[model samples]
Structures are given as C-alpha cells and as structure tokens.
Target chain A: MNELPMSHHKHNDPLPETVLRVKALESLLVEKGLVDPAALDALIDTYETKVGPRNGARVVARAWADPAYRERLLSDASAAIAELGFSGRQGEDMVVLENTPQVHNMVVCTLCSCYPWPVLGLPPVWYKSAPYRARAVAEPRAVLEEFGCSLPEDVEVRVWDSTAEVRYLVLPMRPRGTDALNQAQLAELVTRDSMIGTALPRSP
Target chain B: MNGAHDLGGMHGFGAISPEPDEPVFHADWERRAFAITLAMGAYGRWNLDMSRYARERMEPAEYLRTSYYEHWIHGLQLLLIEQGLLSAAEIEARMQRIAAETDAGAES
Candidate 1:
C-alpha cells in the first residue's frame, strides 16, 4: 500500500538539523574513501523498492491460501519465510504468529529498534518514536485501538516483545468472502499494518 | 547502556502522529544518511551490535535531543574515526565548513 503523505512538515523547507548532520557524515565518509557512493545507492534502492512490506505480504497471502504452508509457518517461521527467499539479518530467527477468532497478536521491540529488516525493510518513524516504544508494551490494547483495531472481549491479545535473538511477524486472518480470491489478490488486501498487528487486512 | 532509545513501556513521550503519506525519508540528507549508514555497515568493519551499542553509549541528553538518523550519523562518525577511516579533525573541519555555508546562505 502506498503511504499517505505525512503532514509532519512543510515541503520545500530548509532541512532539519539531523539532515545536515547526516549530509556532513556522508560527505566525510565518501571523502575519506570509507564508503563507495555507488554501493550506497544500490543498498538504498534495495530497501526503497525491492524489499519491504510487499515481501511480507506475499508470505502472509501464501499462508492464508495454503493450510500446509500455514502449518509450516507456525511451526518454523524462519524456514517458511526463507521458502519465499525473504531471509537475512534481523530476520535470522523469525516466529510467525497466526491471528485467530480467539487470539490476536501484536509485536513490539522494547529495546531499541530490533526488527525483521529483510522482510519489513526499514522501520517507520512512528515505530522508532519514543512514544510508541513506551506505550506499545504498557497499554497494548489502547495502542491497538489507536491503530483502529478493536478486539472482542472473548479474544485474547498476545503482545510479542521482539528481541535481538528473535523477531516476530503477525499473520493476520484472511478476510471473509476471500475464498474465491487467489494468493496474489489476497496479498493486495494485506497492508504492512496487518502484519504488524496494528490493523487488520482490508476487507474485500 | 540502556539509554533513552530503549523506549518500551515508558510514558510522557506523547502520541505517535503517523503522517498520512510519509515518504521513506523526510529530507534528501535523511536518505543519504540511511544509505551511508547501510553502506558503512556493509563493509563488515563493525557488527550491527556495535553500532547499537555506540548509539546507546551516547550521552543521554544528546541521544534524546537528536533525531533517529542523527543517532546513526553520530555513531557512524564515532566508529569510523575509531577505526582510523577518518580523523576527528577532518570531521570537525567539514562540519565547520557546512556551518559557514549555511551562514552564507542566510546572509544571501
């Protein structure tokens, strides 16, 4: 899903202090020959387009369409995800949790920004914000509600605290009346927030 | 060092305002910062753990004051200088030049 334009700042304004610091560092790094500009561009390109939520969406869609795949995903998420060639740093040990009628799952890394980078690309600014890190664990239900996800009283909410040793991904339930849809179409309904357990997959 | 960056379950930081259509980077320099950090990391001179530690090791006030990518550039600068890739003097001089350029732009 394309991100809606963030209204945090006025476009075409002067860059922030952090931006200047970053620019200085990049210039220094290149001037010193510590980093190759071309290599940097290639790396940026990979995360910007080639990898990200789309990769994770495909995995979720595949699991939703195939029961065997769902079983494998739950039993050994790392291997199952690697099946789709989405395995690398921060994702070396991933555990996929299935959302069900009785169970809801959410993921948060309390310590720093330990995330499944290969599958999720870089984490969003909100995900890295001080407010999110502090509130996600203390008041997970309220946090979910803020994200527009309200669970029934009968459903149990499980918040997975991600660590450097292991990262977690939430496999959102397939929407109703999607039985007719193929895996590719199912992926179209799967947004990044769904896998993060902040929001549910779009209804068809 | 369990610093401000380890912000899980703490309070008073306020609500997360997600920009409706936030680009991956807010500024051109932010994109470059992301790329440079990744590029330096790719060289294998230091592990991700070290970078995290470096950022956490930053002064609490400074760490809290700086932006997310700012922590990255700070840590990257420290690591590169420590590894002898660049001298501290060179970084400081370049920063001074940048400040001067900004001042000149303001005057013009």
Candidate 2:
C-alpha cells in the first residue's frame, strides 16, 4: 500500500492571485521584522537539493517500458503510478488521459494550479498563470503550437479541466524507435511539458 | 495549496506578446522546476505521497491564478515558512540589510 500523507487544503477561494498574496505575505513579514533572509535562502537551498526531476522521468520511463502497466495506467492512473512507488505526498488522486489519433487531450487547472506532480514533477513556468488557464481552453491548438506542438486538423482536441481533488497527466503516445531503448534512455524523452501534454515524445 | 505553475492547457490567451518578441522561458528549467516542486511536496508530506499528491490536488480557481514557476516558487516558500527556517520579519531584515549594503558599496 502507498503511504498517503495529509495536505492542508480548505482555504482556496480563487486564492487572491497567488503571487500577489505571497508577495504580500512576504512583505508583511519583512515589514513586521519577522523573517530572516539568510535562513530563508538556506532553507530554499536545502529543499532544492532534496527535490528534483528524476521522479517525473521515472513515471514516464515506466509507462514506456511496460505495456500491461501502461494499460493499467490509462485505466487507473493513481494505482498505476503507485505501482512504481511514485504515489502520495503532493500527488493524491490521478487520471491519465491518452492522446489518440481521433481525440487530442490537454491538461489544465483552470481554477488553480492542480497538476500530476508524481509523474511530471512540478508545473512548468507557464502552466500556473492567468494567461495560460484562460487561453488553453480558448485556444488549445494555438497554445500548443507555441510549445512547438501541433496536431493535424483531423484530430479533435479535448481539454481536461483539472479541479480540486483530481489531478491529471498526459500519457503521450510512446515514440517508435524507443522499443530497443532501456528505461534510462526512455526517460530522456519524457520532458516535463510532454507529460503535461504540451510537447510530444521525440520521434523514435 | 496547489502549486501555481501547472497550467497545461491554459494558454488560450495565446501569446499576449507578439510571437517574435514574446517572453520565452527555457523548457529545461520548466522540467527541472516541475521535478523539484513535486519532489519537495513528496518530501514535505503535504499530500498522501508523491504520486497521489501530484496527480491529485487540483483546485479550480487557484490553479489557474498561479504561473507554473510560481507553483514551485510558492511551494518552496510555503515549505520554508512552514519548516520555520525563516520567520516573516527575519527575511525582511535581511533584504533591507542586503539592499543597504549594495547601495553603500555602489556609492563607495
């Protein structure tokens, strides 16, 4: 069984433009003579060392290697991801939406920055802002094109609106030539954007 | 709180700036940051574990409000504060001190 941790939710309400709120809180702390800059920096450094992208790569690599697992992943993402010991913490509930020829899928947290962190790691620089949330649903193809990804007109684009409690990840079609590759080699193609459905796996 | 920068499909506003001169964040950084954000949460016990937390934890409005990098940045900040590494006032004092030092150094 996966070790499910607890989260501190229940205070959302559009979050008051998170950046502004954080900045406000930070400034308030600074003004109040509360926070120590050096300590904060050091703490950030510690977390930086402890956290990394390897886990995200692992999820992608695993999906690439096992077909049975892949089917399982598509059916029950939370359990499939956990099979590799990648579950819990920031990631609780998960759903994997595959990109098929008939229908294209894109993931977005229109309300807030909900994402599949276990598989893809963190959200990219653009994935957590107003512009992207509003635009992705409005113009997914054009947005994807900006990321150097474009689907043919024949493919229908379906956007996934991730909400509270349910996070989503994109299981891009595995590239061809990768059949001969090992897990590590396969991981190289699982870019952060690819797992989020912004980019595609490299042409194998 | 959900990390801010996981906006996968929220690009509909579609390149506010003109394409040629639009701001371009490095793809590698995004990958690195995402990885870090997820890992930190994994370590912090903020959710049911790494996989479950990352795959879940989507709040509708807040998720859209935060930029992708902001999510990592926010998560890290939250962790720092939560861990008691630096209090609110201490950080400000350091910022002021640094600014003063920089100003003095530049003048001299």
Candidate 3:
C-alpha cells in the first residue's frame, strides 16, 4: 500500500503540499483516462451553486408560509423535501425536526459527518470539527450560546444524534416580526446555521 | 471499530473557533482537492459509505494529526490503489518526479 501523502511534507506549510499531491493525482488519473477535469468542474458547480442551503432555505420559507406544508414537512420530512425536488445520497433517509415556541431541536452525527448534502451542500468545518461534534450533544445550550444563539430558559432543547441510516435537518422557528414578509423574503432570513440548529433566523 | 474520525462528544480538541466570512475554499489547493476527489468518486466503483470508512480506518494518531482534506486525499489514494486503478510504485515515482522538478525550479 502507498503511504499517505501527508507524511511526505515536513515543513509547516500544508496547503501547497496538499495542492501538489492533488495535482499529481489528478494528472495521473487523467493520463490513465479514469477521470476528466470537466467532470470535476461539474461536481464543484453542482455543490457550490445548484444545490446548497438556498434549496433548504426555499423549503423552510415555504414551510413557514404554508401551515399545510409545514405539517407535511413535520409528518414526512423526506417526502416533503422531495416534493421540492431535493433528494438522493446522504439524504436517502431524512427526518425534519421542528423548533417551536416551547422546544428547540439540534442535530449532530456522533459517528461520522453524515449530513443532508442535497439540501445543505457540504458540511461546514465547524460542523465536522471535534470540538463541535463532541460538545454539541453534551452541552447544546452552551454550544448555541457560543454561536450567539441564546434561548429562553422556559424553552426546552432537544438534540438529535444522526446515524448512518438517517440524517436530520432542523427547522428552526420563524423569527417574529416577519409575518408580513413573503416566502422569498422569509428565505432571506433563513441562515445555514439556523437550519443546522446552531442559530436562529435573522429578524426582519 | 470506533476511530478518531468519530469525534462527537469527545474532548480536548479545542474551542470551536468560527471564522467570520470564511471563503468556500480556504486555499486554492483545497478547491483542487475537493474537485478531484469528487471527480474520482464519479467512477461509481466505490460508494460514499466506503469513502467514509476509509477515512475512519486510519490510525488514531495519523487521523487526528491530518487535516480534513488531507484525510480525504489519503482515503482517495488508498481507494484508488485498492481498486487497481493505480499502483504504489507509480504513486511513489510520481512524487519523486514532482519533488525533483520542484527542487530544480528552486535552484534555477
């Protein structure tokens, strides 16, 4: 077996070493006719633009505007999300938990960084970090506080530990003073961290 | 077996420092690493679960020491070699050639 490329670099500079290794691998793969650079670009485009938190934001906005949709979203999140055309790997099994006036929901994958990629795109570094992963479930209140999201003492907090079989999306409660905002406008308030249950939607 | 990659609920890693206005790719190389990994993954030879397992299967020390994308490229290399797509000798030779070229460029 080949040794990991990480060991080859001794200097503190990691970015250039990683870049060089990736380039070497890419060139070899292309020369072998196993992969095309165009395919790489397409994959990047799909994640960066076509699929992302914006897709989840649209779903959240629609849910906030339509009580019926919200009901469906809560009842069967996977199907409800699919209704908006977001489904596939890493999202095969999804459960949408809602945050209400009385309770808040947070998500963490204790085993691996299994996330709903179709909606959230790539998981953030913090989301995959050891600090967040280990602490998110242990002290969720403190974690949220660190993210500048403080909750009422009366409200309850629930943490969901994601597994290989199921991933989760947190439907944060719509902020007040936004009843007049349309779905499109509401989407603007739905930040990625809010959907991840780390923070709340921005007030209008 | 549980590995370092399964870091949820553990401790001592450090504070969760959030970078304000962080870019999608911190460095140009990260973009290349991300894109190349995805491109190679498109072959459909291995599934996402397998990829995750590859990263998780590393030694605890190495896994904890390596960066995220480093883990990714490590797993990619391991998978490609295992799948008969590339050989260890070929990879070593390529790295040596790259090192030599870089040294030559620096000296000139």
Clashing residue pairs, backbone N/CA/C < 3 A, model 3: A134-B9
Q: Name the candidate that leads on DockQ.
A: 1
Q: Which 10 consecutive positions of candidate 3 chain A have the poorest summed lDDT? A: A3-12
DockQ for each candidate?
A: 0.48, 0.14, 0.44
For model 2 chain A, the run of ten residues with the poorest summed lDDT: A3-12
Please provide, for model 3 over A15-91, each residue's C-alpha lDDT reduced to its tens digit, 9 standing for 90 to 100.
Answer: 44566678788879989888887887777777767878888999899999999999999898989999999998678
TM-score of 3: 0.89
| Backbone clashes counted, model 2 | 73
Flag regions of model 2 displaced more than 4 Å: A1-53, B1-108
Q: How much is the lDDT of residue A198 in candidate 2? A: 74
What lDDT score belongs to each candidate, Candidate 1 first?
Answer: 0.80, 0.59, 0.80
Q: What is the lDDT, from 0 to 100, of the residue A94 in candidate 1? A: 93
Candidate 1 global lDDT: 0.80
C-alpha TM-score for every candidate: 0.89, 0.58, 0.89
Model 2 per-residue lDDT tens digits across residues A71-169: 898888888888877776446888888877787788887755667656655454356545566678878897788788888999888888887578877
lDDT of 3 by residue, B1-84 (tens): 677777667756555666665555666666777887877777799988788888787778876666677878888988989999
Q: Could you give the TM-score of chain B for each candidate, in order?
A: 0.86, 0.44, 0.93
Model 1: per-residue Cα lDDT over A23-52, one tens digit each: 677888788787898898887788777888
